[model samples]
Target chain A: MPQPVIAAVGSSPVGRTDFPGRDLFSLALEEAFEGLPDPAELADAVYVGNQSEQYEHQIMHGTLLAEWAGLRNVPAERVEGCAAAGALALRHAAKDVRNGEHEGVLACGVEKMTAGGTGGATDALSAAFDRAIEQRSGVTAPSQYALLAQRYLHETDATEEDLAEIAVKNHRNAAKNPRAQFSDEIDTDTVLESPPVAPPLKLYDCAPVGDGAAVALVTTAAVADELGVPWVTVAGTGTAANNIAVAERNMTEIEGAAVAAESAYEEAGLEPEDVDVAEVHDAFTVSEALLSEAAGFAPTGYGYQSYLPPESREAGWTDVSLSPSGGLKARGHPIGATGILQAIEAYEQLTGVAGDRAVPGAETALLLNEGGVADAVTVAHVLTAGTEVAR
Target chain B: MSGEDRLDVDSPLTLPGFFSALADGDLLAGVCADCGEVLLPPRPACYGCGSRNVDVEPQPKTGEIYSYTAVHTPPPALEDDAPYTIAVVELDSGGRLTGRVDANYDAVGIGDPVELGTRALTDEERSLALEHELEWPLHVFEPV
Candidate 1:
């Protein structure tokens, strides 16, 4: 058995970038390979996470990205689970390293969501839902989430104002992150009054549709040591799939996410309390609240208090910070690239290099990325700070 | 769809078959013989018990709103139909499914009684459907 670690990470500027998908991947690759050999020199395999071909009317992302990275023949493929594609790629690469199948694998994600504009993104994303009912019902992403938000509010003590605060809090965190898309603090009123994309979900409630790319190097311990860069160990990985239709599942609990996170926690031989920081999918404001509870960091219904400082939360809450990278809410979600973005944040946070928003003494981090309307699919990974960094 | 009916187009376990039934005005649900989980738009296996022993049964059209919302922004094909209400209705047969509610945002709430109705796809929706889906009707919920 081998220990897999993330030796390097890089991401393209998130938001409506003027770059295409492959170009975004190239920029990310350049940043990640700086002061090091080209990716072709070390990557034994490559996995690119991309959401749809409709955006650019292009597919075969594996061949395109691998060629762009100057890698010729090594095994390459694209992984798709919508927004969770990035983590799915990382999980595959990490497993390849851990199994001694590959010494170094490139885990990458890219999405040029702005290629077709908001309406284009909307129609493309609608393909993720069940075609028979959900898609035919004219449900946009926000409306699907709004259904959950509506149910969440009705079942919990939380209100629309509480959900609005989640957006505000993430925006405040994003203000400290250079990689974030919306780098300005916002008031709850801004979130409350923003044009309603769906009732119970205003414009601020949803993650922006953006274009971006991210790349991570998953390698064996020796490779990381040789690279002389601070690294983080990939301790555990877990994935779960739920019903495609949101109506079929427990909307309030996000049970699939809970199961997936628990599986990862079990593999790491750790509990929820052991996590110092987490980058859960805040694709929507309600998602942040739901994922907090799913990760076991907060009591049921008390999860909406994530906007408050940990100490100010309910008695059952742990002192864990959520979405310090500002999260999808403010950091901008490039769909496929989002999962890898989570890994990048964890890598930085645990290695003691996360700028202003760093959680002090953070040693362990959790990354949860999801696809589909709710938890149609979810990937959870646990990362621990590695030792003997020559940096 | 456990035995000989697995590939049968007439079986309620398949998508085309399910919609074909809906086109004829009868909603079908798959009840897991083991866990008794009701699967709407009936499928082959039960997610609850992972049982392939599913029994297709006619689902009641009437249900209460388990959850609801209005889509202020919709896909381009339905641009003219913005602000339409939608909901996850828990049917009388224990199966739940989402569909458009014929009402305004403020007109609906959780637990509102509604009944399912079937109709031909509008010209806009039909334009978005595939050759096969052109024949499959659309389903919506009306206040009961």
Candidate 2:
């Protein structure tokens, strides 16, 4: 079957902002309808992906967003898979098109975080874990990932310096992305000298908490052709889940992302070598190295090694062109909206519209979105600008 | 305020039983009777095998830290306890539990031996919980 194609993509700038009277759904609607000729007349269904309703004090956002966006009575619902909620929603919308359920589906993710300060936001994000157990022990996002980083460093030859390089590299990339939350470049000395949030995880190691939304319009291949809009084929998509508690699974292996990416690569009939540009979640600096290994881009115990210098591609170390959109590190993570943003980045890079940060002559792309600690729920997708499915 | 501020002790996995056992001088874990997989927080069912036949087994209190972090930034509820060490200790029974490790922040490291201990909620912590409408585990781990 011809797969669904992402017809259009849009997003709001990612940063820490207090948009006084604006609500979550409206933020989503504004970004979703951006640049569309007549967005109100184009959708058959809406899928809203959000991780925490506690942040906005609202629920049932799918129907709420659809109604607010002037979609009227069309089918609309929300899907949750923690941080990967947006990717999961996009996958569902794509399947809807592929199965002939809806010719077009609007998939978007939005999170309004400033309503609650760091404390409120931290508590809300904690909802992703096994609440009664994990949250009760004072394990917040940084603490959870800190454990993973400690274990990863202990077992591997990689050092904290390698992880710092990742932050430096991502910030450099984000400097070229106008929408990113952080664009300033810092060296390993700065990263190492930064205040420690969780031991081994300095302030620079974490993604900033921010408010944003990202949207993608997916439609049947026929509809995309008829609309005559610039689009990218959703060549493949896969998702998987893992134990909710960090203690239950192997800390070193990102089992969820591995499982999801394997299926995604297989379905796309492509391998790691075939990917030209890729974006993997890097909510924490450690996450980038962990996910790089999980996504098969780097050898086990050597994910951090890939980030080090030959120092440029001409140097000697392998040129792993990862996270060109700044990633969650410098780009900011608005939770629900993050996954869709990855899709938007994929669309931009593949379509040659990624401005200064664009990868030259990029063709094939991969996007990975992860949720919760060690990516308990992960979604992976492969995209191409080509009109036809090569497989 | 009395100890009445505690989390509901009746739920299947409220872990009140686990904390109660610690106060009674024992560490407990739920072991599946059919598959022999041990679970922390005492689940009603076996996650490894589809079996509801589970037993609350006494666990070895001492274990080596599998991983750890000295938390400098904490949630509002844990603000008072900022710079506390949180570690995931792999118990001798093979069940891992995430808990606070009562040690000097820079002194603790991965693989350090630790043992279960009960922590009476401080008046400040209790007030914070009351203020935030939060529930916290009333237990911790200490260097053994």
Number of clashing pairs per prediction, in order? 0, 0
Kindly report which residue stretches of model 2 are placed more than 4 angstroms away from their true locations once superposed.
A20-35, A309-320, A387-391, B1-16, B124-137
lDDT of 1 by residue, A1-391 (tens): 8999999999999999888999999888888899988888778799988999989999899888889989898899999998889999999999999999999999999999999999999999999999889998888889999999999999999999999999998999999988899988999889888998988899999999999999999997788778787789999999999999999999999998999999999988899999999999999999999999999999999899998987789999999999999999999899999999999999888887787888988888999999998799999999999964222
Give each model a TM-score.
Answer: 0.98, 0.91
**Which pairs of residues collide in model 1?**
none
- Global fold similarity of model 2 (TM-score): 0.91
Interface RMSD of 1: 0.7
Model 1 complex DockQ against the native: 0.88
Using DockQ as the measure, which candidate wins? 1
Model 1: how far residue A71 lies from native, Å: 1.1
- RMSD to truth, every model: 1.4, 4.7
Flag clash pairs in model 2.
none
